[model samples]
Target: NRRGLPEGHADVKRMMTVPIMRNDEIVAIVGVGNKAFDYEAEELEVFARYADSVWDSIQVKRVEDALWQSREIYRAVVENSTDSIVRCDVNGKFLFGNEAAIKLLGGAEAAPIGKTPEELGFCPAFRHTWDASLQYVVAQGFPASFEFDMEIAGRTQTLDMRFAPEYSPTGRVVSVLGVARDITERKIAERELARREEQYRVLTETMKDVVWVLDIESSKFRYVSPSVYALRGYTSEEVVALPVDHAMTPEDRAALKALTLDRVAEFESGSLAADHFYVDQFPQPCKDGSVVWTEVVSNYYINPDNQRLELRGVTRDITERRQAEVALRQARDTLEQRVEERTRDLTRVNAELAAAMQVKDEFLSVMSHELRTPLNAILIMSQVMLEGVRGSLNERQLRAMQTITESGQHLLAMINDILDITSVQAGTVVLDRALHEVDALCAPLIDRLRAEAATRSQSIDYVCPSEPLYLWADGRRFGQIVRHLLENAMKFTPDGGQISLFVQPDLDRRVLSVRIEDNGIGIAHDAIERIFQPFTQADSALSRQFGGSGIGLTLVRHLVELHGGTITAESAGMPGSGSRFTVQLPWQAPPVGSPHGAILAAGAVHGPHVVLIADDNPSAQRVMGDALRAAGYEVLAALDGIEAVATARLRPPDLILMDMQMPRCDGATAIRRLRQLPACAATPIVAMSSVVVPNDRALCLDAGADDYLAKPISADTVVDVVARHLAPGRSLIDAASGADARPS
Candidate 1:
């Protein structure tokens, strides 16, 4: 008999004895050397049965031991795995937990065992899943896997959990084994991929050019951007299912196929890549049965896996650009045509201006020659009559001759207007300044126009400042402005109308303001602004009714502006109403070094003083000298400044009226010479000239004369100036009027 011992045990060193039993017969007994305890009969009987029974029982026990060892190894592996391992009862309470599960829970290893999921901070996201998973495990007794998000230990975690049911002998689930893995990072990666995909989709939709990808083997489109809908009216999905050639026109499709094949062959052969192909006018059919132009560019893309090639590229709609090019070409042609037309028009206009200028020059020449000749003849004839060379005339005849002379003067004024207008148009109006008394400059003009006003039964009231008003100005032009404005007022006014003139100093503005107001046929409101334009009348009827050239106000405005002043006309806008014209001129004080000899000389000449007059025209001389003599002054006569000077020297006359433009010595030179003599130096000498321009008076006065006078001087004006200079302290006329008139 053999004893069963543990596997790989060493053999016993001493032999031992045992009894054997066979078929109800006693077997031989064997004696052992020694034993620790006596073998009893009952123990031997148990051993005797095991000789057969013991061997079989030993084999069964050995099988049971191997199975238990394998189970232990599997249990250790499950307990030590990185993944959390757990076993739960049917009620979802934790029945067992490995070290991983305990560590994952971040607490003591003994804490989780026998605890419910709720006690360990495990709550199901959906309550229904708990009941379903429980029911499934109980009914099926099988393993199942599920995904869930759970909050564990104050943090959210994604879990992939597998539940395996533990069954009893009756096939009922006693508990469940669960294996769980944290999959939070995996879920985050999946979400990030989805977000990027959405971004790409949005970018493709908003882009202008069509983007597409093709499957090389199938020769069909796999991807198409949403922009294809805008360019070709084909939805992305529709284009993606169709071959690329289907979208192109037949001609373009053929060309594209050839090019694609060539590129594919080159790529497969490992040769140089075929050149990238571009077609600007590739035709595409729209959903509306219309054709559109597209620009296509493509290259061959070799598929790495199977060595297949695909044509992938973009297509842009070029219809608008093409239309713009066509329109631009047409515009270029139109611009060229317009440029030629303008050139021709300008050439014609230039020729017309040249012709007009030539005609203007010819007209001015003829007008000057014709007007001057007549004016010269009339002037000469008037001088001859006034000189007594044509014999003495009666009062009536003298008056008639005076009328003739005045008419000639008026004609000469018209001629001057013509000449001035021509010169102004030719751009030749220049400023020439001289110092003179404003009142004296305006006095002769006022006297001449007075008679004209009287003829119309009108009266003019003139007022000047009490103090002498001196100004540096162009005297002739200054007089012209006054004359034109005065004449304009008198002509428009009806008989019995009143005209008033005034001069005042404007100290703040440093200007002299001269105003002339009249009761007349006033200008209309619309006509006032245009009245100063040359040749412009208030109305065509005004030209006929007033008998004016309409250039008077225009010339007045120009002359006033030339002196750095402005003139304006204001009217009541009705016939027989009133109009006022105001002129403002810049004023400069006279130099202190200038002589006031004229003022001193006027003081020397007392009442009834002898005054000698020298003028080539006898009428002027007589009228002047007689006016002086009549006003109580003794008068002497001479033909010119030379004769006047000589006569004054001979008779020791108190004053001399010298004609400025004389044959021998001019008044300016004569006065200069006479001033050198002590006897004449203190004498009052007045120089007269017809051309009373600004410099003329200054030239005379600068040469030592007492005062300068402009011709056709009136009797009152000549007497007034002469008297003022003769006796500065006395009444102006007191010097002219002898004792026959009272001093007052």
Candidate 2:
């Protein structure tokens, strides 16, 4: 009472004070004064009860005000949300939806009350899903979320939706609240990503090389290609499930892992660029429990989504290469020791051997460069004239050119035979193996040879399998081998003789036999044994008459052998009975993307196409330029490096054909300068070199040439190379008339 009304009253009539208590705690004092009648105990008690009631009313009003403010805050949040928000009654009917939800639903400000998702014309599947989720929330008295697709507008849209039950005072569920988000774009991106991953998986499975992705930290394969099976008889699925170092010897595995970890650390710390891929070799564990040497090339990359470093790599069986290297070393050591043993008596032999080697080296260099360069020009220019890409020619001239072409081709064949023999002797040539389709190869070859056969008065017949045949081999060498057999048949078959070719696969044996038979001058029965011997002919008289190097069959045999196949000759030894050469090659499907190594198609491109040819040889320049002009490209000829640099600077051409061996600075040097200039940095520059050596190619590439071509480049090669380099997103290739071999 002392604490009531501040103890200051001016009226001094009557006063009453009551304590406002909540849960038996004094919250405040309620007081009233200036009563006219005297107050008794009963009246005071009544006044106290009235005061408690009044306090209860005030608390109730305060609670109502707080609730209204909280609702206003919620409304503000809902209106401004980018996601669609909706409120629904217990019967799965929409109570209300935000502006975003209305816009998403594509309506003109219509009330959403009493409308179900089905009534709103949502897809039935999605509506059913929503109804099920809402029912679950209502039943469980909790929240639920799901992702589903709906066609609100014309296009389908993906949405993430969540439903939460709203309960009444009695804990009865009355309504539901939902938040929906339009994730259509995100869903589309996810599908696209899945498609690409599936595409990658297909490509990986088709590869001949063991391609894999590794989680570096876990040392486990995240992905692997089917080539693992071919390499060591392990399925792609099996390999991926194995540890990263599953195929290495324990010692090699430990060492390699350490090395790999160090490299990974460098990659993560920014010391090494992701662009660089490193190579490592170690022994691999085969599914058969055998160990084979493998060469692994790997690059570090950061997976964007997970931000984890990953290793993408390809592995190849390198046991043969390693063995070859060791054999070479042993041979060298033996030769050195033998020389030392015969040191006193071998002075004359050593001098003779050195002189012989020098002569051989000079011959090879001239044959590849000096000899082939001029021949390339002649054959290309002749071919262009024959094709009528140049002006028309009379019959006599055309026939003469045809004679010239045949002669040049003969000379080229002779040159190639020598090259192959040399490579075999030196052991320098290795197979650039790839996949090829048998039909695709044979069709073009037969078409090409038919014209020559017709001229020779030889009628040809060919039989192929009903189904498409695919095999793994060096397409160029395979084509070459087949062409040789056919050419031999065509050459020997007398005028009006029939040459028949047969291709059939032995499915059970997994081998394919290409049988070529000619009803021409057959081998003598006595001399059949010497027919395939190198540099030997069936008969001296027949050799003179047929006009052949006699080594064609020898080279063919070698090529077949290199491809791990066999060749056999059958003849009745009666002249005019013809001969049969059957090459039985093992059946293997070439890796994916391998057939492309042999074929190139340059689609029509819009262009006032400019091609710049930089060569010191005027004849070579003339040859390539004419070919370019024929292929719808404007030609720019540069005689030397200086001129090439100047012309490129004056007007940047779409492509540059840089000759590596040039006066006053070579093509490599010029390429370096041209690449330094921004205009030519990305311009395709194919380095042409008469050196025909691996080192020369390495030098050209190191100097920034986009591609490299050895000498003996022909018109078709020139045209093809230009088209290949100019074609959208195609790699450069060799200009040789042989196999359209891609640049290594």
Candidate 3:
């Protein structure tokens, strides 16, 4: 019945039966109708042969189908797994691309299939690998696998490709199969890790520090950087073979072992940090067998597999830095010590300066008082003699009296200089304010010195401006300054030398310049700077020839400065040249109700009564004493402090006459001591000294003396001082009393 089916149905059944092969065998059969038309004998024979051949082909295909299924399962399992998979043909053409590969390529498997390695942009190494795989597969007829680098879509990729040869039953080549995995990420990670390891190795090798790894359990070197050779004179290989403990001396080894064991225990107990310390583990011996100092930082690492601890450490030679640190510390200490020493020295200097200043003040005070006392006696006695209080004298006696007067005046001038210098040095000079007409103030001084100048055959020319120059200043001090400059010029100038004085306004600076120029011995270049210093002469010979204390210019400079002015000297060096002195004074107008009228009124008086006498020599004292006794009233004698105090106490004298120096006590000390006594305290003390400083008069006043008068007492000074200090009635009475007084 199955054979009687229609021809169409029979073909249909055949088609279904071919597909029904399972497990490589057919379990049942399906029948179809016979051919529609009756077959001839030839046709029937052809059909039977075809049917037999078809059945054989179906059975062979069944085996092939089973193998193909098995292969599909294997492929699915391999490809669907998380691993990347690919397959290529002998020519390196993609035969299959798995899910992982498709995902890596960001596409479906069909996109990569049928593409050659070149088309897929595989790198040369991959292409070569593929070719080698193909060659090996062809030769051995077996599978092969290799790692390769490929460039896919401009990105490099790493792949592990496996090749398998498909062989026929005779073992002849048929086709080749390849499985590829995209191991790009894994390869990259591996390469990065290797690179990091190489970098670490290079860093360690190049470092100045020594790096080491040791096996804790055995105390043996696991690794050491090449620099260990430089540090400890041991190669890495040699060190690795020996126990780390063996490299250390016995004492150091014991210490290291103890320290390492402790650290390992602490690490196991979770009590030790990554950082630990070890002392002198690796000592580098120098050429001379001396050891260099080193410091080590050690840490522990536990191996994951073995649970063994490794001691990894770095050793640094800190000798140089440490030495530098020591040196810096030493320098700091030294600097601090020097600062302390300097501070101490400065403190001592300050103390000494303070003491010196104190001593200076005391000395000035004492000197002023003592010198004034002697000057008073000389001045008073000189006045009495000039008044002709005794019987009329001969021409010789009158001439001698005149000499005494002149000498007394000279000595008084010297004492005044000393006081001025003392005051200037002590910074105590004061300006007495008054209205002064420049020409009028200078007139008297010029007239007085005119005769002296004429005696030298020198001409003093006064050039006054048409308009009067009136200023507010100390008139006496200003006159003194002008006179000093003029006198200086006169002394230096030879006979017939021309001296000129003139006043002019300095338009730019609003000042008045008083210039005195003379055809005199010019100052040398070397002496110019020192000329203004007190007691400094230009040259020793000049000092001797000039007969000056060298304080005139200094006093002039001080007075000018006090008046807010400046004075300067100019000369064309040496003989045959002339000298010029220019004084510049700030212009200040006099007050509306100034004392100019009073000064003129006072000038009208022919003389002053107050007397001051100062002398250092004893013979000058007797001569002065005899003159003063013949004149009138009480006389006080002070040989020294003792005599001065006794005489002053016996009678409170109108004025004190002082000597600068005396036996038993110096004049300065004597004056100070006398000033302390009550009786003589109020009396006017006058300073007299051979040695005169620029500020001596001021110094005398500062020590409580009233005025200054110099040595070699004169009759006129005595008469002048008595007239100045006495009441008008007393002065009149003394003038009359002079006729009755007897010569001593």
Candidate 4:
């Protein structure tokens, strides 16, 4: 009955119900007494105004609810963040701090709302710097960040801090918001990483091995060691420009890549064990287009920056080692063939076994000569290359040649040593007996030893008499004995330890007592007696740690005995306790039949250092004499080789300048004859000739000249040649640097 009708009209049919009008109040009510619509236009307009008012209130409520939710979300984000966040006014009062901020400031007591940085007791360090930074940001209205250290809760912390100004609507910075991160652990880690990088850099640059790092993704070398120059004849920078396969043959490269990729795949798929490395050997081309055998070892690791796997490894040029193995194999095959042939004639072989041993000894001597010949050439050529004889060389090439020369010299020394020991053992060392001045021989050796000692921070205290101690023995072999003892002392001595060599003469006994003592690692009591035995050492482990031929002492003992002498060793067997080696040799004074002893005296030189010039060519002799005279050297001219030797013995010059070819006797013959005299034994003799070839120099050296100089010689060349040979120390240490570690 009341449908579409005003409320309260159900009971009374004529009743009119209108909502109470409070200007803009209710337009309608659910139970209001119904008012019949007798509509006036103004009345409807008033109703519309009331409806709009109701809609306005509801919209206001919705907006307020939405803003409440947004504030809550922002509050949650600030609280949950790991970063320490704080909001402060321009005066540096803490307006607000998040959870992380409170925790970082030692939980709430040290830092709280309205408290300034000065009030934060948990982290007093960096307070001044932090305050300054905040003030700057507030004044400048800019963002700033810095790293500083802080003492926090008994631990030192490195903080990464940032400050930003929060502006008001008027564009003024009212407060500064700061964020601090404790990056203490990170900074320590970074420092450790830097230390490791520097260590590796030093190792690679100094090591003889060639280490490399490669970018697998780019298929390029990223890092190459400086030592690559020695192995491949290429500079590190040059190697970086080369592709990984640039030096490999196509087939080898393909095979290598296939194996490498298979390993990589296995690693990625977890089929390969962790930390497994790959090993390979292949022939690689050098800068000179020669092939070298290389042994490579490598492993893959991910690059932290790009997250890509890379290759890092060391390579060794094993060409020499491989060549030696081949030679040994060839020698074995030859021996097996000879053995089979001898087996067919065993009866004949038994009859000539002693003869066969003699042949073997001769063969070894010939082999030694053959080896030295090429080695001399190699040493000369390497010197030429190092000096840029053909053209100027870069640093890499120079260093490479230096290493080559050093290695060649060391090999030559080893060959000489082995051959000598073999010859002595086989009773084939024929002594070319002559008068040798111990003092003169020791001069050059001590100089060499001092150079060696300087590298190890060791010192040699050598004391000998001013007078020459003449020994009638093989001069070369005697020199070898002293050198071996000195080298042995140096090898065993620790850094900063002292090695003492004293040569004392026993006039009554007609003998010399040479003592070489070192404060070093000593020998065991049981091993002292056996030390002179060939191939025997105090401990085998020492032989491995400190490399030796195991024949050094054996050679020393034999050489000493060969000169009618005896050698002995004494040690306490305690670590850091020293050992002493004593050698006694028969000391024979020089021949007294000649009156040349006065001229041979050390202080007898009254003029410029005397030099003997011997040349059969009349014009040549004059030119040589004039050159020597112009250089402030007293010249003793000899018309021929025969006269040269006689004159050198009579007038013991400081130097002998000899021509290779002369009448009646050659320079070689003259040198040999002069060397036999005690007065001329250690004189510096230089050969001047048109031939500067290595063979000619070797021949002259074999004949006992100190050095060789080609003819067309200038006065300056003569002076320098004389000066060097007179001193005879051209830093041989640099030539045999690596070998100095082992006793010769």
lDDT for model 2, please.
Answer: 0.79
Badly placed stretches (over 4 Å) of model 1 are 1-88, 94-125, 133-223, 226-325, 383-389, 393-403, 422-486, 493-519, 554-744
Candidate 4 stretches greater than 4 Å from native: 1-35, 119-125, 215-218, 250-271, 300-311, 337-345, 349-744
Q: Give the alpha carbon lDDT tens digit for every residue of 149-229 in model 3.
A: 766667877778777787779977766765667788888899999999999988999998989888877878888888877
lDDT scores of the candidates, listed in order: 0.75, 0.79, 0.69, 0.77
Q: Model 2 compared with the native: what TM-score?
A: 0.41
Could you arrange the candidates by lDDT from highest to lowest?
2, 4, 1, 3
TM-score of 4: 0.40
Evaluated with TM-score, which candidate comes out highest? 1
**Segments in model 2 whose C-alpha atoms lie over 4 Å from true places:** 1-17, 31-43, 88-93, 109-148, 163-177, 213-229, 233-246, 250-258, 261-265, 287-289, 301-310, 321-744
Ranking by TM-score: 1, 3, 2, 4
| Model 2 collision count | 3
**Per-residue lDDT of 562-659 in model 2, one digit per residue for the tens?**
66578988888776788999997756322244434343221111223568899888888866764454333556778888999999998888889999
**Alpha-carbon error at 490 in model 2, in Å?**
48
**What TM-score would you give candidate 1 relative to the actual structure?**
0.48
| Per-model TM-score on C-alpha atoms | 0.48, 0.41, 0.41, 0.40
Distance from true position, residue 413, model 3, in Å?
A: 9.6
